[model samples]
Target: MSDFFEALPGAVGSPPQHYGNPLGEQKILVDGSAVVDLGHRGIVTVSGSDRLTWLDSLTSQSIAGLQPGDSGETLQLDINGRLEYAIRVVDDGDTAWLLVDADEAAGLLAWLSKMRFMLRVELADRSADFATIGSLGTPAIEAAAPNGVPLVWHDPWSSVVRGGHQYAQVAEHPGAEWSYSETLVAPSALAAASALPVAGTLALDALRIAAWRPRLATEADEKTIPHELDWLRSAVHLTKGCYRGQETVAKVHNLGHPPRRLVMLHIDGSDGVLPAPGDPVAVHDASDIADAAIGTVTSSALHYELGPIALAVIKRGTEHDAELAILSDGIRIAAAQEVIVPRDAGAEANVPRLPRLGAVRR
Candidate 1:
């Protein structure tokens, strides 16, 4: 931990959620003049000649072809195709750096270690060796190069990569304007980096939600599939050969729709309180006797540009034009849904459907 960050005014918690002014910090951060302390994140390193191929065989993205300084994101799914892990990957030829949520590092490392039976790959949890700092522009800190490899992971959410698919049909995606990256630097360098303009996770998250970026820590539940978040836009390689859960991925994209879809909520801030994750997202019946549970708020933030916005995952059958409401702490906050993944998304192969077994031909 950086003594400078710990001693900063209004600093609190292990990661310093904010330094006095979160919204102000967000404003500067969006202007590309501030860095956010992300020391709470976790880092893992994979090395060995087979590192790339080994990862390729286990993840949703095509990793075998990544070269030095190449960046990508990948997902680890359960056999049923529910998301288990989401990883930010950057390769430096000799080693691959994996940046993940702090809570996920240990479990991910254990899972990977169990899978490395005969592969000549080595894995290490490097969170203690380096701290993560994020910026909207190029990283403000000089990245560490302990092994002659600069460790910085440029975010790929700005655009879809090859073999990746986008489910959103908007004329323009908000993520196009997002320029985010995370840099790993020595703990000793944090104090020096903190000398520059600084933001906090709250600011970073507000920007992230505005960008329509799906973060694993919040966006995913045990039942989440990549398609629901449109994660294939930058994370999954649809054409990539077999990997864990690939079967379900291909099947869903080719012939089925995800049971749920992601949406951005323009929350009514009249209550002067932001809705937290897991809040019920619903719609009132015409009689007003009941409220239909459509989804749950997954992430929420007060963005500098957009106030009190949130992301939710709702039932695929939820009417797109329906008026939505968020129930938080016994207060009902009206919300307007901005579609992230359209209800009609998927079945990209356009396979012709067959008539029902008992249907009579007209």
Candidate 2:
């Protein structure tokens, strides 16, 4: 927790988790009546004529043509297409502000510095100059326009953008109503915000989980790819020109399937214990194995409307209707699966497989 977070009244935990009313906070937050102190978030600024094009040459989003006040989410993937950084970016004409979890800020800055060989871009960690505040509407954030442009970054997760894909097979995605945004404010503005009803990260995360939002900080592992979490819906642009990890992304979405897929688990809360992240999710009915684990829970929360729910990543072959169990602290809890990324998600081009040279044509 930063000094800013510690100073908030009624705050709890090392990095305050809540003001002792997370559930209640969620209720009010949805209606834009409350604000969440996101002081733990980090901000980095990039300024230069080459900033936009340079960023376009990197990351997974198509932002080279981004105009001032345009907000988007982009993923920084490793050479092999594994996620490294999930960046929320907003440009204010003079600079591009990159927002991320605090732990990722330093590394993201370092990586950008290393890549700015001949570019005119300059980078800085502006976390000390600003704090982050989250809200569902612009009323709380619209006044923080330092450069005559509000720094609030409206999330693009509500719908699929051009060149993006949706893997979740549902009549309506829970994220359609997720109108979340993070705004950067000065220290004075942050202090003045104490007058508003305050929520904590716990409340924010609960709403996020119910919305089926994939957070890179919690959901990603070394082997995880965008396709597995349906990240392409917001972060990756399929028709964009070449960038890091673009080949692997194209290959997976066109010719192959992601090894794993994300799912939402509606947990049975009779035990009164919610499963934690990294808990093993297994098939409830086993054949030969004693306890066969299928996937691992990535995040869990007691949702205001959904009771207890979690997001887990399971094998692509796991049956969509499989009865699932989560092993948390030696307690086996039954869970019902909600398909996120379907089993047949990839191979979008649907090219036919060719017969082997040694085999006769059928």
- TM for every model, in the order presented, reads 0.96, 0.96
**What are the per-residue Cα lDDT tens digits for candidate 1 across 1-362?**
55567678888755777898999999898788888888678988899999999999999999899989888899999999999999999899899999998889999999999999988899999988888889998745788887677888889999998899999889999999899999898877887888888888888899899899999899999899999999999999998889989999999999999999999999899989799999888874422212567789999999887899999999998888988888888777889999999999899899998999999999
Candidate 2 segments whose C-alpha is farther than 4 A from its true place: 1-9, 287-291
- Candidate 2's C-alpha lDDT? 0.87
Candidate 1 residue pairs in clash (backbone atoms < 3 Å): none
Candidate 2 scores a C-alpha RMSD against the true structure in Å of: 1.8
Q: What is the Å distance of residue 52 in model 2 from its true position?
A: 0.7
For all candidates in order, the CA lDDT equals 0.89, 0.87
Give the per-residue lDDT digits (tens) of candidate 2, residues 268-342: 999999999999888887542225877899999988999999999999999888998888888889999999999
**Per-structure clash totals for the candidates:** 0, 0
Query: Candidate 1's error at 79, in angstroms?
Result: 0.5
